[model samples]
Target: MAVTSVIASEASLFLTPQSIIFDEKSRSQAVHVVNRGNRTGVFAIRWIDHTMTEEGRLFTWKEPDKSPWSLQPYVRYSPRRVTLRPGESQLVRIALKKPYDQVPIGEYFSHLNVVMLNKNVEESIRQQEEGSEEAEAGVFRVVARTGISIPVLWRHTRDQPAAEVEISQWNSSQQTLSLQVKRLGQVSTRGFLHVIYQQNGKEKRLLDPHPLVIYPNIDGRKVNLSLANRALAGGKLYVYYSADKEHWDKPLGFASIQL
Candidate 1:
């Protein structure tokens, strides 16, 4: 019997167009993945259905009963596996194919996961036979695999979705504000959350706009944002959630609280 082990190296991967959306009219999209690290990386691309917790944590949904919002059955991606050298890039094309007549109409969600596998099988076998110096030095070389994920959403129609965000609670001692974002329609909403502090007719941004999303499966999510002490003294805080710059005039929702 023979045993083999390979030293694992981390790869710095960058993905463009972080979030993808597929509509009734457009059913295909491509994502660009780049390996920024010096070592060569092998990635396995796949789809994973996820559920977001109230506190903004994502967990894989693998129960016997599938979620109504799961996009697993309808989505497909090309180049399930790939090997890239440093500074190399690959485009993963994703397509959606749903039996619209059978499935319910709404938004579906899934995550595209890029996972790094063990590197250089031949080199590991050679090292094992040679009893490498690192092995003589008693230094353990463990294979550590890592991955990156991005959301891929699909909708049956092009109709606009809406959601409402309100300041649910404030922790003065901790300088944190809890926001309750409630989904209003059957579709999901993705946008930016802007927090503004207005005092005596003057307004200033408390924090850089935060990326916000409300998926269809869940009714609402709670997001906690930290506020600077100076901004909380004697002003009114206003929060606005808008899908994008083009839809600024028609914001999804807004709420305010006086400090």
Candidate 2:
């Protein structure tokens, strides 16, 4: 009998705001997770209150309606157990609840934990007592710890207006796509351009550009997208933007051109 050693790679979780702006109503925050490991890993996370006092810092756990721990208010698990096969990565969505006119104007903090479950702990212990030929019984067990900080800012209302996106032009000869965007109001916007086309009622993504950052007051910025050697036979082109990658808005601007 041969034994294989199992080890966990460095795993981490982070929120875009690190600090967030919360209105009276409930608002959601986006979190990105990176799995830098050869095997799949699982994570368990919850939000705990961390209040800053004159002396130093005081931590309190919040218990929401339904969760794993009583002290933790909101607990979430990745929808599916993430299986990362050598350099694979994934993202998870988390929602933060803020009751109307409840929280005061200040900085609030919370913690998140990424854990890996041990699958071979019992087997390892049993093998050790049997005097197996293998020198060591190799132990695999679930590991968990808490060490992530989530900072949030409370505000009354949204300060800026939503952003607008459009597809300016499409060049079939050159196999390139051009995009133009206008800032309707003033809100720091970040999103990517996703081009989807339909053929025989079957939808497929034509080109996905890297997420672009649009600052306030920037009238129209052009993003060059390459669509070379792609199947664009008979389909309509659609372009749109989104605050979160998972959810995308309707086609603000579009053009029907053939390649």
**All-Cα superposition RMSD per candidate:** 6.6, 13.2
Q: How accurate is candidate 2 locally (lDDT)?
A: 0.49
What is the alpha-carbon RMSD of candidate 2 to the true structure? 13.2
Q: Whole-model Cα lDDT per candidate?
A: 0.79, 0.49
The local lDDT score (0 to 100) that residue 111 gets in candidate 2 is: 46
Clash totals for all candidate models: 0, 6
TM-score of each: 0.80, 0.40
- Candidate 1 C-alpha lDDT tens digits along 71-144: 88887789988887777899999987756657677788888988878344445557888889988899987777
Candidate 1 — which residues are off by over 4 angstroms? 1-11, 63-65, 119-141, 170-176, 231-235, 244-250
Native-to-model Cα distance after best TM-score fit, residue 14 in candidate 2, in Å: 6.6
Clashing pairs in 2: 20-153, 62-73, 64-73, 117-142, 118-141, 118-142
When summed lDDT is taken over every stretch of 10 residues in candidate 2, the lowest stretch is: 66-75
